[model samples]
Target: GENVGLHLPTLSVQEGDNSIINCAYSNSASDYFIWYKQESGKGPQFIIDIRSNMDKRQGQRVTVLLNKTVKHLSLQIAATQPGDSAVYFCAENIMEGGSNYKLTFGKGTLLTVNP
Candidate 1:
């Protein structure tokens, strides 16, 4: 079971700080990785994506680092804000024998922003 279940349900941070979210994957065969951000009662929004061919990818104010040696993934967010408070999830898509891609999602990391 590579699902991410948070030991700490909430994290409080001040605005203008940075945040780091961690996740663990169960399947080693997964090739694609994605990190999503979700607001209160809203659907997850795509933040950034990285393929297995690479080790790290960066986006505007966000960075995703992947370590294939340990099957671990992380999301680094710069500048925390009240609007930045949300749940983050790491997802991986596994390509099986067929053309279909199955995505398995981690539980989530809840980030609370303090003004």
Candidate 2:
């Protein structure tokens, strides 16, 4: 119920511009959140993470902001580049079935950089 469907599947941007990708999570009790970037045919690489205690976190060329009130999260990428083109996913860690930790993922946002 908290999944925010994207109005557009992909975003095209010029090189050196900033890009913002958004995601929505279903559970408010989720404790940990991570943003990952996956290049074509590659595994998702951890970009940044934010905890429930914090509302925002930053990494090299990227910033992640969380809004617990609305269960929304966003990733901001500075200086979009051809190498930055990839699919990004936001994941939330939740307790499932006993003591197991599970990560639920959003559909993903595709970023295309035009050189």
Candidate 3:
């Protein structure tokens, strides 16, 4: 099986500081986008999402931005904490045909928050 999500770029931040995670999507046809947080021994959890029609979306302390022109995506975390330490990822939904779509994920990045 091919690995769709397997890379770790380390980001070190202090508690109460802002953390930004970047992801570049390969498919321009992707319409839906989602950010996921995966703690050790746990599965990826949905953090936030934005549609292709929208430029940005916010949820709680997190914000998701999409640039369709460049096929780029980013996640911003406000007041990064130790609890926020995890592997963060972005997934894009690419529709192949009517009612059938495939989800592609970016390489996961490790976010480390220090006190």
Residue-pair clashes per prediction, in order, are: 1, 0, 0
Q: Write model 1 residue lDDT over 1-115, tens digit each, in one string.
A: 1222246366778889998889898788899999988876677899999998899999998999999989999999899778888888899999777787899988888888888
TM-scores for every predicted model: 0.88, 0.89, 0.91
Error of 1 at 15 (Å): 1.1
In model 2, residue pairs whose N, Cα or C atoms come closer than 3 Å (at least 3 residues apart or on different chains), thus clashing, are: none
lDDT of 2 by residue, 1-115 (tens): 1222244378889999999999999998898999988887777889999998999999999999999999999999999889998888899999888688899988788888999
lDDT winner: 3
Q: Clashing residue pairs in candidate 1, if any?
A: 2-26
Model 3 deviation from the true structure expressed as Cα RMSD, one decimal place: 3.1
* Candidate 3: residue 2 lDDT (0-100): 26
Ranking by lDDT, best first? 3, 2, 1
Error of 2 at 69 (Å): 0.4
Candidate 3 lDDT, 1-115, residue by residue in tens: 1232246788999999999999999899899999999888787899999999999999999999999999999999999989998889999999887789999888788888999
Model 3: lDDT equals 0.89
Off by over 4 Å in 2: 1-8
